[model samples]
Target: MDFYLTALVQGLCYGSLALGIYISMKIFNIPDITTDGSYTLGGAVTAVMLTNNQPTYLILPVVIGVGAVAGALTGLIHTKLKVNALLAGILVMTALYSLNLTIMGRSNLPLSNLPSLFTLVDISTDTNLNTFWIVLAFIAIVTLFIGYLLKTDFGIAMRATGNSESMIRALGVNTDKMKIIGLALANALTALSGYLITQWQGFADISMGIGVVISGLGSVIIAETLIRSLSITSVWLNLLLVLGGAIVFQMVLAFTLSTGVNPLYLKAVTSTFVLLIVGLPRLFRREV
Candidate 1:
């Protein structure tokens, strides 16, 4: 039970990453690999700040800002320099590895002894329970904020910029600028996931974000599968499904581990699981 609970918390942590991926891949149709770097950037920033006795509230905005900058750089490279989207993301992600190392001054930073956002409130006697509620509340707030943002006039313009760039551009929308801002917003959310996970895991490692984008992609794909199967079109419901997908993805992994799968083979297992999620749906659809 405790193991599954921990996985639930982790799922919530990665919920932010799923949201970020949804914005980048689903909305903008850009497979931004910057997720790998910006995620660790958030953890790096959070770990450094917490070790230095920084307030949690103060550290969050800084994390978001730094993540946005990393994402915006990718967008700039893609839009202004005429780089392919994939290559631009790869360039920025490569650069962020060194930047993260420089920021941390080492390979890992421990935060076990430090006060964190999870410790700010005591909701239950069990530490895991408290962390669960804190994470849930934070995710809920973020989902609501994003859902509201997507319904506004500016948000509609941003969506338009992604759906039909030329049409939106002809209508006086700055498509390039929108792309930049969209990527920035996407990475900012991804960074927030890093912020939460670092504290939850009690340490931040330079390698923690490696291949992290796969989890996010898997979650988004899961959500997309459900959305298509159900023909759901409401933005709020879609956001909730994304969060649900993140949780389900993590839960599946937790179940796999519980079944005595070798830890060494976890990555391979994850890949296969994601492949099944992606391929099974298409196969069934084709058969039907």
Candidate 2:
């Protein structure tokens, strides 16, 4: 029971990242690979700052800003330099790998003394605030912030840009700016998740971002499958569904690990699961 509870909490953190990916992939219609790098960027920055005695509260905004800048750089490459959006994200992600290494000044950094938001909570209890509560808080805050942002005027414009670039331009909306804003918001959310992950785990490693993009996408796909039947058409529901998907994915991973599955083969299992889920919908359908 304790093991499942722990996995559930950890899953929430991972789910937060998946929600971020869903915004870019499903809502914005932009398959940005910047998530892989931006996630590391957040961890690197947070770990370094925490080691230097920075406040955890401030880490949130700083990580978000840093992530936005990274995403904006990718957007500029694609929109301004006319690079393919897909390739531009890859370029930014590649550059960020080195940048994260530089920020941490090493391959990994530990956060032993640094305070986490969970630790600072006013709940006076000997029991270390369980991972479940901490992750739940982060998820709640992020979901609320993102849901609010998506309901704003600019958010609507950004969605319009995704649906029809020419149409948005025809309406006199600056599609380039919208795209940039969308990317920034999407990646910033991802970075925030990375920050939480670092603090939760007590350390940050450069290689942690590896295959993260695929993991996030997998969560989104799984979430869509579960909540596709929901009557709620709002984007906020989609966010919740993605979170649900992440939790499920994490639980499955934990179960596999506990069942004597080799850790090294975890990625293989995830990949196979994602493929089955993605292909299953198409394998049985017939053309009308």
Candidate 3:
């Protein structure tokens, strides 16, 4: 019971990044690999600031702004320089690695004894239980903000830019600007995940975000499956499901470990599961 509960908590932390991935890969139709770097950048920034005794509340906006700047830089490179979006993300991600290293000034930074965002919360007697409630509250606020954003006129225009770029452009929308804004928002959310996870887990490591995109992709795919099966048209519900999918994804991993699978093969398990999630849905649609 504790194991599954722990995974659910872990999922919610990573779900922030998952939401970002959904925006870039699903809505904007861009494979923004900037996720890997920007995630670590958030952690790196937070870890350093906290080490210097920065205020906990201000970390939220500062980390989000930093992540947004990273995303915007990638957007400029792709839209202004006409580079492939994927490559632009890759370029920024590569540069960010060195930058993050410099920021932390070391490979790993530990915050085991430091004050944390979760330090003030006393929601539950058990540490894990308290962490769960804190993370839940954080996610709820973020989910609502994103849901509301998607229903706005600007958000609708952003969606159309991806769905029917020609049509949106014909309507005099600056599609490139929309893409930039979309990517910026996407990465800001990713950074928020970093901020929470770093504080929750009590440390930040350089490699924490490596290959983390798979988890995000899996969550998005599962949410998409739910959207199709339920015929959901409401933007808010769809976003909520995406967050739920992240929790489910983590539970699946927990189940795998419970069955005694080697920890070394966890990534392999995740990849296979994601493949089926993505391919099986299309296969069923085609057969019907």
Write model 2 residue lDDT over 1-288, tens digit each, in one string. Answer: 767777787788787688778878887788899999999999899999899888888888999999999988988898899998899999999999999999999998998866886676755353334556666877898888888877898778877788888998999998888878788888898898788889888899999898888778888888777666456567788788888888888888889889999999999988887898788866766532
Candidate 2 weakest ten by summed lDDT: 122-131
Candidate 3 residue pairs in clash (backbone atoms < 3 Å): none
Q: Each model's TM-score, in the order given? A: 0.99, 0.94, 0.97
For model 1, give the 10-residue run with minimal summed lDDT. 263-272
Q: What are the runs in model 1 whose C-alpha is more than 4 Å off?
A: none
Q: Roughly what TM-score does model 3 have, to 2 decimal places?
A: 0.97
Clashing pairs in 1: none
Query: By lDDT, highest first, what's the ranking?
Result: 1, 3, 2
As for lDDT, the candidate ahead, 1 or 2, is 1
Candidate 2: segments with Cα more than 4 A from true spot? 122-129, 227-232
Query: Clashes in candidate 3: how many?
Result: 0
Please provide, for model 1 over 1-288, each residue's C-alpha lDDT reduced to its tens digit, 9 standing for 90 to 100. Answer: 999999999999999999999999999999999999999999999999999999999999999999999999999999999999999999999999999999999999998789999999999999999999999999999999999999999889988888999999999999899999999999999999999999999999999999899999999999999899899989999999999999999999999999999988888888898899999988998999
Q: Which candidate is the best by TM-score?
A: 1
**What's each prediction's clash count?**
0, 0, 0
Higher-TM-score candidate of 1 and 3:
1
Report the CA-based lDDT of candidate 1 relative to the real structure. 0.96
